[model samples]
Target chain A: MASLGSIATAPLRAEREGDKNAKSIVFLGLLWFAILFAVLALVVLLVTAFFDGRTRLDADLITQYSSTVFPERAGARAAILGSAMVIVTTAALAIPLGVAAGVYLEEFADPRRWYNKLIEVNLTNLAAVPAIVYGMLTAGVALSIGLPRRVVLAGAIALALLVLPVIIITTREAMRSVPQEIRQGSLALGATPLQTVWRQTLPSAIPGIATGSILALSRALGEAAPLLLLGGLVFVTYDPNGLMSGFTTSYRSRSSTGRHSHSWRFSRSHRQPLSCFWSCCCS
Target chain B: MECDGVDVYYGDFKAVCDVSLGFGYNEITALIGPSGCGKSTLLRSLNRMNDLIPEARVEGAVTFHGQSIYAKDVDPIEVRRRIGMVFQKPNPFPKSIYDNVAYGPRVTGMKAADMDDLVEEALTRSALWDEVKDKLKQSAYGLSGGQQQRLCIARTIAVRPEVILMDEPCSALDPIATSRIEDLMAELRDDYSIIIVTHNMQQAARVADRTAFFTALADETTGDRTGLLVEYDLTNKIFSSPADERTEKYITGRFG
Candidate 1:
C-alpha cells in the first residue's frame, strides 16, 4: 500500500526526465491510440454497411427476395429470415450436445484413460478446423442423409458441426472455474454425481457456458461458406417456408440490392440478369 | 473406520505410501505434518473423495463399519454422505444461508416438513445460530471468514454424517476464529468422529484426542517426495514423549 501511494504521488517524468514512469505514460497513450483506431475502423465500416442502401430500404426489403429480371422488385427478406432460422436451429442442435459432452469430460471421465486424453487433444484441433472443411463435410452428410441440398436445416447442420467443439471446450472451461471444493462439498452431502452437477456445477457455469456458446454461434453466423455450400449465396425470389426449402443470406442480397436500380450509374442492361439464372450466369 | 496399507497416487506418482490408521468412534484425530506430507491426500482418500480427481488412485481397502468402501458395489457418493468433509478455504455456495444448510438434506430427499428444523438444529450445533438467524435469507458470502467456515460445518452436519474430515479448516481464519472453531470441535467430539489435517501443532494439542505425525521422505537427486506416517498415539503422549525421534523433533519445533 505504501509503495502504491508513493508511485501515485510521484512527479510527472517526461522529456529529459526519462524515468520508468515516462515509458509507462507513453505505453498508456499507445494503448489508448490502439483502442481508438480499432473502434474508429469498426464505426466507419458499420456506418457504410447500414446507410449505404438505407435510402432505398423499406418493408419490401424485409418482405421480398432478389430477382434476376426486375431489379426494383428484388429484396433481402428471404435471406434475412433464412440466416435467423439457420442460427436458431444451429443453437438448438449444438448447445445440448456440447453441454453434455463437457459435463462428461469435466465431471466424470478418467483423465488417465487414453480415449479421454485423445478427446481433449482432438477438441483443441477441431476448434481450429476451417469453416470450409465443415462446409464440405456438411455437403457429404446432407447428401448421404437424403436431405435437400439447398435448405435452412442443412445450413444449420453445417454450422452446428462447426461450433460443437467450441461449445464443449467453453463449457468445460466454465465448469472448471468453479472450485473443486464446491463439487466435493456437494458430493460429501451424499448427493449423487448427476444431482451434484445438476444442482451445483451447472447452475454456476450457466453464464460462462452461455457467453461461450453465444460467441461461438456469432462466429458461425458470420461464416458464409457453409451456408454457401447449401446454395446460400444464390439469388432467391421466394422466401423459405419449410425446413427443407431453399434459402439465401442477406450478406449478398442486401448488397445485391440497388445493384441495378438506384446504386447504379452505368447502363442497366449490363447489370440486370435475365429471368433464367443459368443463362444469366452465362451472359 | 479404518484404512489398511493405503497408498495414494496421482497417476504413477506416489503421494502417500503404506499408511494404516484406525479412527476411534466419537473422537477427534489430528493428522499433523509439514507441506507435501500428504495429510490432506490421506484425509481425502478416507471418504473416497480422491475418486473425484481423475488421476488420483487409492490402493488398499478403506472400510467403514466392516464394509470395504472401495468395493465395486460401494458407491463413493454414498460413502461421502456417511463421511463428510470441510475444506481449507471457506467455500459456501453462492446461496442464502438457509438454502446452503438445506442443500444436502433437500438432495437426499428429506421431508419438507423436517427441513426448517434440520437447518436450525445444524446451525445451532455449529454455534452460528444466533448471528445468522435474522439473516437466513441473506447470502452466505455476507458472513465473515470464521462464520462461513462454521456455516460450512453446519452444512456438512445437516446431513448427519458419521464422520467429518477437516482439511486445515481453521488455517484461513484469524486466531480468535481458530479458537472458536477449536472449541466447536471439542463440543462436537462426543458425536461425530473427526479426522483433521493441520499444520498447527498447538491446534492439534488443543482439540485432538489422538495425533498422527507424518513426514515426507525426499530423494534429493530425483526430487521425489513421498509422505509416510511417522507416529500415531494419544495426543498427550505424542506431544510430550513421542516414540519416534522424528516425532519428538517435529513436536519440539526443531525439525526442518
Candidate 2:
C-alpha cells in the first residue's frame, strides 16, 4: 500500500513540475514575440528616418531628372517619371477591368457553376504566381508580334497582368461586403438590377475598390523585377512624348478634385474595351 | 387592389398558397399571423418585392387599379415606384437625414429646386420635421429606432407613391414609437393605400381598418407547408366577435 502511494505521488509531482515548466515556456514565448516585434519596428523606423534625413533631397529630385553618378547631377527625375508612367498605366489598365471582373463574379456568376469555380481557383493561383513569370510571358508575346522586347508598353502590360488578380480579389471582397438587404431594398424600390448595382451597390463599395486599386498601384510602383525583365531603362534624360516613349518626366500633377487623375490619354482610351473584355473573359 | 389565387414559392417550397384578398384605396389593411405564416410574403407580393429573391416564384394575378400587375408588359420597377414599402427593421440609408428623404425623389429625377420643399413636406407628414429640423444634415444612422422608422416613412412619401406597404414597421420600436408610427399611418391612409403585416394583434386592432388572419397549412399529398388566409373582415368585427372559431382562438391567445 505504501509503495502504491509513492508511485501515484511520484507521477503527480512530475505533472506539477511539468505544468510549471510549461507556464514558464509560454511566458518566454510571449516575451520573445514582443522583443521580436519591437526589434523589427525599430529597424523599419531607423531605415525610413535614415533615408528621409538625407541632405541631398531637394527640388532637384523633382525637377532635374536622372541618376548621374556626380553628386551635383544626381536626381530622381527620370525614376519619378518612370514610376509615374508605370503607376498611371497600371491604374488605367487595372482599376476598371479588375472592378468589372470582380462585380460580375460576385454579383452575376454562380458559385456552384463549374466554370465559375474554375475561374475563381485560377484567379487565386494567378495572384500567387511570381511577377517575373508575367514579364517573361509579355516578352514572349512582344517578340512574337515583332515588337521591341523591352518597351514601356510591355512593362505596363506585364505589371497589369501581375496585379490584376490582386485588384480583382480586393474588389470582390469589397462588393461582397455590401449587405444583401441593401440590394433587395434597392430592387424593391423598382430599380432595375443594373441600376441597383451601378447606383446602390457600386457606390457603397467605391471606398473599398479605391483602396484596393491604390494598394495594387503602390505594389506595382515598387516592383523592380518585372520592370527589370521588361528592360525598364535605369536612366533616361527626356520625358515621354507618346505612348511608345520611355518614362522621362514625373507626371504627378495636382488636380482640382485632389485625386490622382492620370492624364495618360492612350491608357484612358483603352480602358473601355479592356474593362469590357475583363468582365466577359473573367466571368 | 386584388390578388386572385396568388401563390408564393421559395424554390420548390411553397411559402404562401391560394390567397385571394382585396384592399380598398386609402384604407389600412392589416395582415396578422404567427411566425412563418406567410403574412409578410403575401404583403411583399403586393409590390413585387418577392422578385428580389432569385428563387422566389409567385404564381397568380395581382391587379392594381384594375390592371394585372403580373402581366408580361407590366414593369415591376414602375409598379414598385407606385407602391412604396417600409421594412420591419427601419432601414434608413447611411446618408444625411435630408439625403435619406431626398433619395427617392433624386432617383425619379425630381427637379433639384423642388427637392427641398418635397423633403420638408414628407418629413412633416411623417411627423419627424419637428425633431430633426435642426439637424437635417446629420447622419440618418444616428437617429433613434423610432426616428429612423419615421425617416423611412418620410423617404417613401417623398416618391409620391400611390400605395404604401408596411411590413411590421413598428416591430422594432418602443410602444411610444409604435404609437407615433400608427398615428402617421392613420394620417397617410387618407392619401395612400396602406397594407401592414403585424404580429401584434393589438396594433392591428388599433390602426387597421380591416384585419386578415393567415395560418399555415401542411399539405398531406405534396408534403409541403403553405400559408393560407383564415379569415378577413372589419377590424372591429374580427376583434370583438370573429365568426371563425380559429380566429377567435388565435386573437384570444388560446392557440396559434
Instruction: Give the alpha carbon lDDT tens digit for every residue of A233-256 in model 1.
Output: 466666678778777655232233
User: What lDDT, from 0 to 1, does candidate 1 have?
Assistant: 0.85
Tens-digit lDDT string for candidate 2 (A1-283) = 4675556443433445654687799998999999999998667545544553355456775666543344344455666766777778878888889999999999888787999999999999999999889888988888898898555677888889999999999999999999876776666565677777887788899999999888888887767677767776655777665457766322222223434322211112233553334334422
Name the candidate that leads on DockQ. 1
lDDT of model 1 at residue B61? 80
Spell out the clash pairs found in candidate 1.
none
Provide TM-scores for the models: 0.85, 0.82
Candidate 1 C-alpha lDDT tens digits along B68-145: 999999978778888999999999988899999999999988665778899999999999999999999999999999
RMSD (CA, Å), each prediction:
5.7, 11.3
